[model samples]
Target chain A: MDSYASTRLTRIRTAMKDQGLGGLLVCANGMRRDHVRYVTNLNVLGSWAIAVLGPERGPALFIEDPWDLDRARRDSWAESVTAGPGLLDGIVRAAGELGLRGPVGVAGMELMEAGLVLALRERLAPLTLQPATRLLVELRLLKDEGELRAIRRASELADAGYEVFLGTARAGLPEYELVAEIEGFLRDAGAEDNMMILASGGVEVTGMRPPTSKRLQVGDLVTAELTPQVNGYYAQICRTLVIGEPSAAQQQSFEIFWQAQEAAMESARPGVTISQVAEAQNEVFRKAGFGEYVSKRYTRARGHGLGLHFDDEPLIWEGNDLRLQAGMVLIAHPNTYLPLAGYMVLGDPLVITDGGCERLTKTERRLFAVAP
Target chain B: MKRGLVEWDRQELPEGAFAARLAACRAGMCEERLDALLVYTDVWRAGHVRFLSHYLPYWSSGLLVLPLEGEPLLLSTQPQRVFPWIAETSLLREVRAAPALGKAAAAVLAERGWRRAGVVELQELPWGIYADLTAEAPGACELVDASALMRGVRLSEDGHEEALLTKAAAMAAAPLAALDPVGQRDWAVIATLERAYRRAGAEDLMLLVTSPTAGQWPGVPREAVLADGVLLQASLEYKGHWLQLSRTWLPAGASPLRGLYDRLGRAYAELSETARPGLSEAEAAGLLKRLAPGDGLHLFAAHASGSAPFTPLPGLDGIEEGMVVALHLGAEDRQGHRALVGDTFLARREGLARVTT
Candidate 1:
């Protein structure tokens, strides 16, 4: 529960040793560099690095870009460090520094283009270039306490933003104003940077999209799916609220959706098949004659993992074959549209627990009615 | 803006270039023996869509019904009775009302009486379509990942595309260099880039701003302080074009940092000179790393293009002639000192041309 970088690195090194690999090459730039920060604690803006592990050397960080060297070393979990450019050459140099030559297992080596692969092989002709896939992403599928905290913080920010909307948003208010308020609040609150899109559900059907200057109309469903990234961890919190008095059909739709969400959440637990959670939720809708409507209109998974990436996997869907594991943070929503009702959505963030799941989002998951 | 690169311009892709790419799509589909090649265009672009359709949809989503046989139709889901966006694109046959978008794809296909097809851009195609397309179609419409075709076509940037990126990089770099350090150790560079993007007429903006200090963040903007000699890698996204650039500012008089910076500048040029055309990216990356100073000196190893804060490059990139790249070169020590010099260039046979210049 005491999340530490070195401890994970040890587990990773053990995996590397089992694979008989010398080093794992990881690249980062722009937004995708979350993995680097997750590992080394250094955000290499425009750099590439390969983390090498030899039986004798333990672990080392070989980075190319100069800007992050001091920071990478200062922040890195590993003590063995070197800076240089050519990936294979840098790895080779790190390999040489550790006196590891003959055969070194490489993770990103197989991902190289045919030409680059040939060139690398030619350069390190005698050394064995074993194939190893990038396993760092999979390692992140499950979250520890520290990771959960970051996600929880992100979810709390989303909750605050929702509360702000609930208090301020109303019919006749332009969509962008609501969007701007949420983004401005998040930025000021010092949350992990954010990029999100919003949709004002008046336009026939609206998926979460960038806020236009579209004014909210009476009976409009204002849907907002905003993901504010926290140190590379992404939390997708989507909430739909009625602008004014909802139509009877719309209110009815919300009730059915509210029940479906409950069924799904109650079924989701550690070791449970993701499919079971999905089925349970769909069953609630199925009994209500909304089963066929869900399939036709509800086009996304019931829930997905929130932290690290948009990794809504071990996906809770009909055919999804992934099992939920403890500490896995997920967002669940049961949303669909019947011809009579325009749209319906119910969302909540949950953490997989020992027996079942813990609801992370404290928001009232229902049709948040707003008076114009 | 940095050391080299002063000349820059956005030379638009030729009028016929879009048509040619579409023709290439048709040819590719025929070769793959796939039915129809479904392409997409949207605001949250993957960047490859513009290479073929020539129309950059500024809305949430757009779809291209690129049949191996007929003229491609650009189905925009921006809710218009009239296709107002048709003027910007070279794509013909615009369908305005996609009332039931998920179901429309199959209806359109059935109306055309098409059976086998390949869908490109899997990321944009939602799960609903995956279910609808398979269920509604008469038989399995042999969907292939048309994205590979996109990657293959995008092996190198054309001269016109090169020009756009160059202008973006050059225009983006100047203001950043001239920027005064704000009060905080951390400042928002992406916000500044957006201002620069508007100054340079960039239709959409997505740039990377990274600082060694505590404040810089990715995608969205964040505040970070820029001390003397902090090397910032600012990858500018403009008018849907991407440009990679880096600069080191030595606030007036910082000698050792400046000296180390000068050394890196020389090394970058030297690396450029030696970077042969068609050099495998790994070879080119290796060449750059080998030049990185030994003990007393330091530098960022390097990646292929300056277009960062992140990329999917297995390493840097294979340096090819006529291809544009940002060779990142910078160094910082434990003293909170950093200097960076990055130049965008077009690889030539023996030498490289600084595209921004």
Candidate 2:
């Protein structure tokens, strides 16, 4: 096995032993696939998959789609790979074969199908099943060299995507079409996936969303959060641009968001709580007299972690006391609605270092302008 | 997940279309003796809710509460700040920002005094949501699995659905038709298709590329250069509708799989010809066996398409009018020669019509 896989396996087995778990069942679908990918190194497609890892034996991978069997065998590092017309049956058989006699930990128990969980509980008999999602999260919280490399590549792609966005944003261009151009560019540039949301308007716009049919007009403020994933690692860059020469109010709004994002990024270092980072950003907004927008009423998170999953842990929000550590990667975006210029987004992806955080995104932190 | 163009085009799917869908769902609820129906939706599975409310969730999850009498309500996990956008894009007039979907849905049931709530695809509902729903609800409220009921209601396509499927099929096929895999890397080929699909406004895509030299099984396209004997499978969603198309490409030079490709083509023709209304999935498999016989063929998937919860063939139901089906057939010989062909088809009253032509 590769060193990466070996290290990960050792960590997982140690964790399992600590919890007195005989086995770890990691469940994943197209949406919640980070845990399974972390274990098996197979990017799951189709409905769902389960990775059965026991302390004594190598992991066994079971996928829902039969057509994906050959690929799973070829791609996954699991000792045995199985696919199904009957996925639950395969998972149960594999679990039994692995000799999981004690309580087993399931990483994605809450996301699994209700009937599947009930059936597993009934079939597994006295072997208890425990929720272990937090365990996986804790294990993946730190970034390794290989993961950081992939995130860095994804950050480069995100920058390229924004360049395309800037070039494509013009008057009479529909928001969806503009997004289409950016997506095409990113995909061609080797991005496996991109989670992007954009909006174009002025004071009427509340926040960014999936591309709409609305056409961009002169002086419109177009904000986009472009997150591109490469090799299962996602990096995000949120920026706002104007179709024409920006008004004084738009530039003023942009300053607030830029300052807030800078503050948040500056506060993001090892030993600092995520809440502190969020408060740092919110404090800027409060000082600017737009403190009301800091709540959930006007925004979601000041920033959040980005990794295998687009939205990972350490969500930079109030009440989240998770402390930042070296090797943790996150995006500090003070994205919210500003009554002066509608909504603005200014953020950059960064990795917390031993002393401080280093910004991964090299895009200039300013409101870009395009000719009408 | 689906970060592509997600706007609801009223011209394509008008408010009346959603009204008709909601009406049909309410009619189904009445037939099932359900006081309300709850459809769970996330980024991966948003079809049922999208069909009823034109609300395709971009992230997180949500619950659609359709009472037997009143207009349907959408409880989204997205922040309230985006509720105005959801309301503007969807037919839902009532969009609540409920991070805890089950608790909110239970409250809705309690407020409506619903006694029997049918949860579509109840088995697939996340355990947390299911547990919360059952725990927080009134003591007398009953939740039953209504997967089959929703499937039965959605099995047949309406005019708007058929139109969307047709457009999606064309969009999926155009890029493949224009692809030239010779001497090109797999990633480049995928990039070409991705560019085309996104340019055409595909909401989502699932693409796989396979070659004999690279591997026998279709996998996510990688950076290996392609030579001959390539298979491309593209399944894309456009405007909430899905269509799949698979094609095999061979160089003009002599290849061992030439004859096999011809045979696969003939087999696909026979399968499409025999796929008529009322033909059971078992019957379809039987006909496939008759066409290929012995170990000459391998069936990948033959199933209903055009929406979520794509029911595979050899299922409980037969081919029905207005149902779109995707059939994929593959063949391989001892010498490692292989060929595969597949397409999406629409079942009409008269016969089957290929949608991915």
Candidate 3:
């Protein structure tokens, strides 16, 4: 048995044993298949899967198509991973192979369709099925060292991309055009996945998005939101800037956000629940009389998990109480925009540590002016 | 005269508006009575889904099942949080993880105790999802295709949607016009183009550009001057709307480029000729082909853009009156190189119409 497969099998075994589950099948379906990729190193976009952590013996990684068997052989170290249709049949067929049968726990079971669920019920007339969320969440929340490194790399590249963005901002530029340049730079800087949203129209403000052809005037509030992916790991960095000369109000807004951002950064630490992070931001905004914006005009928790998908679990919202743990990468931002009040954007990628949090990027969080 | 993209009233689309479209699909399903109509979409299949639901599904693939009658149910994956942002009608919904999609679907139908239901576009369903659905479906119920159901309503373009697209298409050139050429780097051209599209108020745009040399393979911008003789090809999209166009200028002499351009340009009748309902897709292709001079495939024009891209969106949606389309059929042969002429087109009920003619 390969090392990682054993590691996965052991974890699955523990999960089934812990949950009193007979079996737990993990899958990546639609946009949710990223987990399968995270575990197996196989980025199957077409909903491939693995049935792991059967109560008795262990688990089996299953692929939808037989064509991927060799890729599985080359990439996956699992000994019993197999291919083809009727995974439920495979689950039944491999029952003895797994050395356990009764009370199987299926994560994706309820999510199945009407007719198929009925048919599967007939097929699995003997066994039992439980909800898949808790088991899957258990496997996902714990990040391995390799995963941590990949996320760190993605974050560093994001910061470098921001540096390029700061250096490139100038007058007579369009919002989308600026983003394209940054995208091009990020691509060159070894970024594999990216979701960029930027905006820079000052007169009538709304929010941020991917750069548009809206030309940057002398005082346009250029906002760039970037998420760079390192091998499927997402790292987020958002920054706001001014075109040409910076206005006094813009400068003031930038400083306030800068202070607020530093405050939030300082507040992040291991053992602290995610709500603490939100509280830090809320404390800043509440001190400024923006307390009424909680869950309304402006959200209190703008921070969240930035992982496989740019936004992941454990959101930095008002009520979320997940504690910060080592190896968990979070995007902490205290972003709030009130109409006629200008912008307040402060966010950075951070990895939880034994004591405090470490920023993935070292770029200064102060508002910058575009050079001529 | 323009407005911001996101600033528009999302209510312009409204909740009940889609129900009518689905109801129309159900009417077609009843024509043969499909077990249920299956409309499938993934991150890759979002464009097709967007054609029905304004929400674009963001990243997850979604399935909307509408029976001949009764409430329609939408099934999708977990982390499937974006549904509400796009779902206005009570009709939209979500399923669990992707694995048991079939089983869940069957259970839903069996609970209803329906005997026969029709599905549309079953071919596009993911194989795993399909297999699971087939395996788990109630033995008493039947599943089949009713493609005619959705196709019946798919041809008609909505009023507000057309307005939004028209406004978006007009933006194709808005940023281009505002771009300053001097002292700008190669990436500046791309940036300028994006700004042009954004300033023009496009919702979600996918603009791809390449100088003549980069055609074989794609390349980033170079420090090249945007002067007269540059053959630039730009593929533009707004709100997942796809349009292709090309524009070129002749620094040497306007006569040759203009002369060659006039031949293809004739097909691009702005207000004089508009694509209406009766015009078959083949006829529009023929008109574009005629501009090509020999069966409509070759070096006369580099590219053209609209619904199906160089080829219009398939099905019965030919040039219909009141529909907006891009008429990018122009060329410049000053240096004997192919010309890139791209523009927009609008279809009117009576006379020919062109929005950015």
Candidate 4:
């Protein structure tokens, strides 16, 4: 109906044609759900779902929950929304109605249960089911105007969460209470969901989880990765705070990561490979005599793509040579464990532009020293 | 020299509680003639894993392998970077940082020389991983669906689980006592509940807020100025057990729900009285339908709640003693005013006792 929806369908159809797919069974679970949301514009509340799309005919969305059927019809661009108390039957019905005969593409199959796929194979005999995960990921690689708007809003909410973190990280406050305060601020600011991990201690901290009853002590280093989702688009911001005056070793440990993150951002220009950006940060660590700590032993990832899902394609890590393209949003952080300061976190969301990139979050990046 | 949330600690199951669960699981494995049991869980469905192993995985996928005899192993996709946090929260001894699930599971089975293995809820496992396992360890081990075996052991709440459920219900109910509807928004109300629940040791929460204008349906928290009468409902999961809570904020004037709440409260009381060891699920459903006759009742009037959400729905067989159940009741007047009440009840041979108030 709308031009944007038409454009999206056309782009997907082109991909389907290129892949020799007459129909595409786009599956989404709680883990890999951006594809269905991208095509249907409906953020599925259920755990798993599928969208049956034909190159010529309109798409049919199959949802697990009956209550969600009404919401899907209202919010989704798909012309048909069917309730699938059992998803396999819904898929069969959609395929029959759409008359999709020939090779069918299945996306997000990794998240799909093995039994479901086997059932589909048995039920839809003679129809070839091919992997279409890459097609969907490529389509979502670049952000459109509407997606950018949602990502901007999500990033702003994450910034608001950081502000709350700054104000609440004080001595004697339990970690979970501070987590509650930040989460409360985000929810009140219209964040639909959030995944925040935080840990606070004096150099003995390992990582963060949902706020616990552990109270903060003076001179504690509080590190948190605050990822808030608004309208299904997630923007992540990782920041660290000191409960009181920071020690010399603590400040120095934070500076290493701050400089590394800056180096990564400098190489995040369009047309530059993601590995180049990672190399820039890894070089910083190596120069500082912390080269050995840059691997997975010390950090999970140097950074990763940010969008509807927390980690998208073109993950910014060593050996990943995917080139950076304009409109691709990323949360680049060189958060690693330091010998003296433990695990310190400092990262922000930014979007690749035609030239360089623009930071989406406005929270200050320097080590925040909260008053006791 | 000191800075931390020292008092803040994860709500852990007592060591004896874990030992009991392991004993029960091993007994089930023995009865089923299985050498090992593999339980897979993601964020959505994790009660099975959390019930046996004290590991509450939030972000990624995890597998808990319990052999017929030996220490259980936690196969975590998270890197060694999070091993410390995992160790702090879980009771599993050997936590293997496994990126590839199928390979890791196959290796464990091969190492233990397990010939027969049971997979809990085969329908829930990813096909890719199953294919990989079949390819990797063909004939090395035989896998069977043991979901029924797990359900038999975890359908009822143990003493420790019951205690956690009681605590979760109280935490979910605290924010409703003083919710000011005059100027609060829907998200603000939800925020209040989230904060209170987390502070009171809630691990997971599914909250919904609605009003006369918004209609009575669960949804994400949005900015809507609360009207005189607003309904706040939640299904809180605390330390792996669940309970339901619903409260209404009435304006100063006379409200239609004033009578409805009393009627629903009576229905809950009546259901608690009639619910016993021998009462069938259909019989309980009949009693709830007859007592709390209304237009706004969900699909199930009463169902099992511990470990899994609504395991045995209405029309099922008899309810067993020691089973934790969530009783949901609601009513709507002709003028569109609605009153909803839900709570967790433990069915015992002596009688039914409400755990969540």
Candidate 5:
């Protein structure tokens, strides 16, 4: 195993021991893979996968799709890998073989299929099953050097995707077609996956959604959150642009978002609560007499942690008490509705440092304008 | 994950089709004595809900509540601000932003006084959602598995669905047909294909590459020089329908595996020819065994395909008309040389018609 995998395994094993778990069954799917990836370093592609890790023996990876067996064996750090017609059955058999008769923790249990969980409980018998989703989340709360490298690369790709978006957004272009251009560029540039959502309109647009057939018109505020994943790590960059020259109202509305994002990022330091960071952003809107827009009625999170999953821990929102720690990676975006000019987004991916935070996204924090 | 084009084509999938689908689902619910049927959708398994509502979530999850005799409602994790877009893109008029999908669904059931509720793919429902739902209602509601009912409803494709599948198959085959893997890097080839798929408006895709001789399993593209005897398997979704196609690339020369490739092609042809509406699973397996009778053959041969979460051919009784299936045939020779070929086919009364050529 590489140093990165070795370090991760060591940490996971230590956590398992501390939790009084005899074994760990890490589950993942295409949608939620951080748990399994953190345990086995495998990028799952099938419907679902499970990594059976014991105290004495190494981890054994099991995937549902037989076609994915070879890939899982090749990519995963686990010594024993099996592809199955029945993923849960394979997990049960592996657990028995590993002699795990005590309480076994199953990460991502909440996200797992209910029937499978029930079957596992019945089959495992005396071996109790425990929910370990929080355990995995706490382990992945901080970014290590290897993870930082991947996140930095993903941030770079997000920047490149934004450039592609800026170059492709034009009047008369369909929203889907514009997304296609950005996706193509990102894939060609070595991004395996991206979570992108865009919206193009004037004040009528409330927020970004999956690309639609609506055509971009002049003076439309095209907003997008371009998050690209590289090496199983994700970084995001949210920005808004105008198809034509920005209007005075659009510019004025965008400045507030920029300021809010800046304040949030500045407040993102070690020992600061995520709610404080979110309050900093909301305070900007409050000073501008748009405080209501910061609530859930008009917007979601001010920002969120970006990692293997698009929305990770320390989600920057009011009332979230998770503290910012050094080595934690997150994005602080003041993306919300502006009465003067639709929803505007201006955010950057940054990593919390000992003193403050370091910005990973190099995109200029401003309202970009594409020539009509 | 599906960052590519994701727009509802009103002309391709009209409102009438969604209405028909909802009506069919309600008909099934009525027959099953179900007050309401719930279809959960996420990025990975959105076929059931998308089929009935044309609402494929970009992220998070959603629930489609189909009452026996009322307008269907959609509860999504997306905020209410994006409901207008959801309404515009889908046939759903009542779209509620439910952060907790199961809780919201449970509340909806309670509000409607629904007692007998059926959940499609009940086994696959997330444990958290299931707990929330069952906990919220306790013994007041009864949830039953409706996977078979849903499957029966989706087994036969409509004309519009077939057209979408045909288009998706063609799109999947386009890049493979144009690929020149000779002297090209593996990642470059994959990147080129991905670009093509996205440019053609694919919503999502899964591509794997393999070299049979190197004892390597089919895997995501890595940085390696591509040579002769490489296999590429691609499954791409257009709009909401999925189609799979596999091809083995070989340099033109006196290759040792030419005979194997030819034999595999013949087996695929024969399998396609023999697969009809009434073909039984045993008969299909027997035909495959006779065509490529050996211990080196891969166990997985065929599966029903048309939407996300393609069902394997084991639990299903047999092939039927209008059913789209993807057949894969692969075997290894005594010298360790291996060849695999596959194509998506549409089962008809006469015979199977190849959808991906």
Candidate 6:
């Protein structure tokens, strides 16, 4: 096993021992399978997969599709990989063979249909099933050396997407076409996936989404939340660009958001609560007399954690008391709505260090303008 | 990757279309003596809800509580955050935030006095919520499986849906027309094709690449150099409809696999020829076994397409007029030669029509 995998397994085992859990059941279906990916480095893609990690038996991978059997064996660190007609039966058999007793920790239970979980509970009677959501989140909160490298690569891809945006965002092209260009560039650069929402129109644009066929006009403001995943690690960078010279109102709104982002990033040091980072940015809007727009309706979280998942944990929102720790990666974005300029986005990923935070992305924070 | 509950279209579907779908669903519920229909959706499978209402679920699990007499209610964990998104994407008027979906659904049943309710994919529901719902309703409500009802109702496509599928298929195939495939990495080719499809209005695109060098049927793309011969599978989802096609790339000088491609093409043609509206599942399976060269583990040779692909597998009831199905034929030899060719087809009384040329 690689050093990273060894270290992560050790950490997970330690946590499992502390919680008095004999075996951990990690189930991943169509969505939110980060726990399985975190432990096994295996992606089920469109199907469902489960991993059973035991104190004595090590790891065994279970999948529904036969095609994934080869993939799991080839890509995963699991000692044994199982796939066939009776997948659920295989899961039950594996649990028994692993000799799991007492209460078992289950992750990704929220996404599992209630019927499946109930059935599993009935079949695996005498063993209690408890939510290990907190346990998994705690394990993935810190960024290790390998994870840091992957995040850095993902952030670089986001920057490359921005460069594509700068080159392609112009008048006459449809907004979706620009999406194609930006995502195409990132994908070509080895990005596994992209979560992008782009909106381009006059100053009064309402929101962002997957690019529509709406044609861009001169002086339109384009705001995009470019998030690209590299090796399952996601990094997001939000930027707003003008088709031509920005209006005075647009420039003013940009200045306020830029200052807010800076303030938010400045307070992202270790030992500080994430709410403080949010307060610093929200304070900017309040002082500028735009405090009413700081609500959730007008904006998403000021920023959130970035790692295996796009929006991880410790939401940087007002009054949240989750303290910052060294090795926690966050995106300090104060992407909010403005009456003058509508919705504008600007932010970058940062790594919390002993004294301060290190910016993961090197893209410029200025209000970009594309010449007509 | 799993599908997400996010609308790629900035505009909502026509109000009349949504109304027609709801009317069809209500008719189904009425036929089964169900007072209300509960459609469960998540990030992975949001098609049923998206069919009745254009709104897509995001982050948390979602449910559409459609009563026989009253307006439909959308239950979500974060109604406020999802309100504008739903408003922008759907025609539904009522939405409620419910932390506990089962209790919330039970309450809806209680409020409407819905004694006979139907739940689609009941087995997929979480046990905890199922327990809470049963506890809350006790003997007041009886839940029946509505999966068949929903599937039968949506098996055939309307005119608008057919047009959307055709357009989506064209968009997905546009990138292949320009791909030379030589001297390029798998990632580069996928990236290029994904860009073209997404820009042309594909909400989600799934690409699988394989080659003779790789013994696997569907191979993951990496930094490996492209082989002289390769098979590319592209599946595109647009406007809640799915379109899938596979293309084989070969150089002009290659004649060794000419017979293989010819046989694969004939298999597709033969399947299309025999796929009539009234064809039984057993008859279709027999025809495939008699004509096809390779074995299909689950009869994936020709499967129905929708929000998800090849769902409900292919049964006697699955074949119908105006049904859109994907024809994916795979052949292999003991010598490790593998070939797969697939595209979307429109089933007609006469025969079949290829939607993605």
Q: Per-prediction RMSD in angstroms? A: 9.5, 2.1, 11.6, 3.5, 2.4, 3.3
lDDT tens digits, residues B1-357, model 1? 010111112245665766666677677778878768776544434355566655554444566787776677766665442253344244555664564444677777777776566766553354334445556755535455676665555554565566566667677767776676433333344444444444344433434444433422222234455543344555555434555666655556645566666766777777767765666777765765676554133322222332222233333345555445556655545564445566666666666677543
Better of 3 and 4 by TM-score: 4
lDDT of 2 by residue, A179-275 (tens): 7788777866888788888888999888888886778999999999999999889999999999989999999999998889888877888999999
Top model by lDDT, which number? 2
Best by TM-score: 2
Decreasing TM-score order of the candidates:
2, 5, 4, 6, 1, 3
> What would the TM-scores of all predictions be?
0.63, 0.96, 0.60, 0.92, 0.94, 0.91
Model 6, range A284-311, lDDT digits (tens) per residue? Answer: 9999999987898778789999988888
- Candidate 4 on B104-199: residue-level lDDT in tens? 888888888889999888777876667766677647688899988887778645877776776676776677676685457888888887777776
In Å, residue A192's CA in model 2 sits off its true spot by 0.9
The total of clashing pairs for model 6 equals 6
Off by over 4 Å in 5: B138-140, B210-214, B276-282, B293-295, B299-307, B314-322, B333-338
Q: What is the TM-score of chain B alone in each candidate?
A: 0.74, 0.92, 0.71, 0.85, 0.92, 0.88
Q: Lowest-scoring 10 consecutive residues by lDDT in candidate 4 chain A?
A: A63-72
Error of 1 at A184 (Å): 5.1
Mark the 10 consecutive residues where model 3 chain B has the least summed lDDT. Answer: B299-308
Best of the two (4, 6) by lDDT? 6
Query: Model 3: chain B TM-score vs. truth?
Result: 0.71
lDDT of 3 by residue, B129-191 (tens): 676677888888888755555555654556655665565556665655554543334445555
lDDT for each candidate structure: 0.58, 0.83, 0.57, 0.76, 0.81, 0.77
Enumerate the candidates' DockQ scores in order.
0.08, 0.66, 0.06, 0.42, 0.59, 0.43
* Model 5 lDDT, residue A63, Cα: 77
Q: Model 6 over residues B56-134: C-alpha lDDT tens digits?
A: 6644567889888879998876536447667766766798878798899888888777789998877776655666777
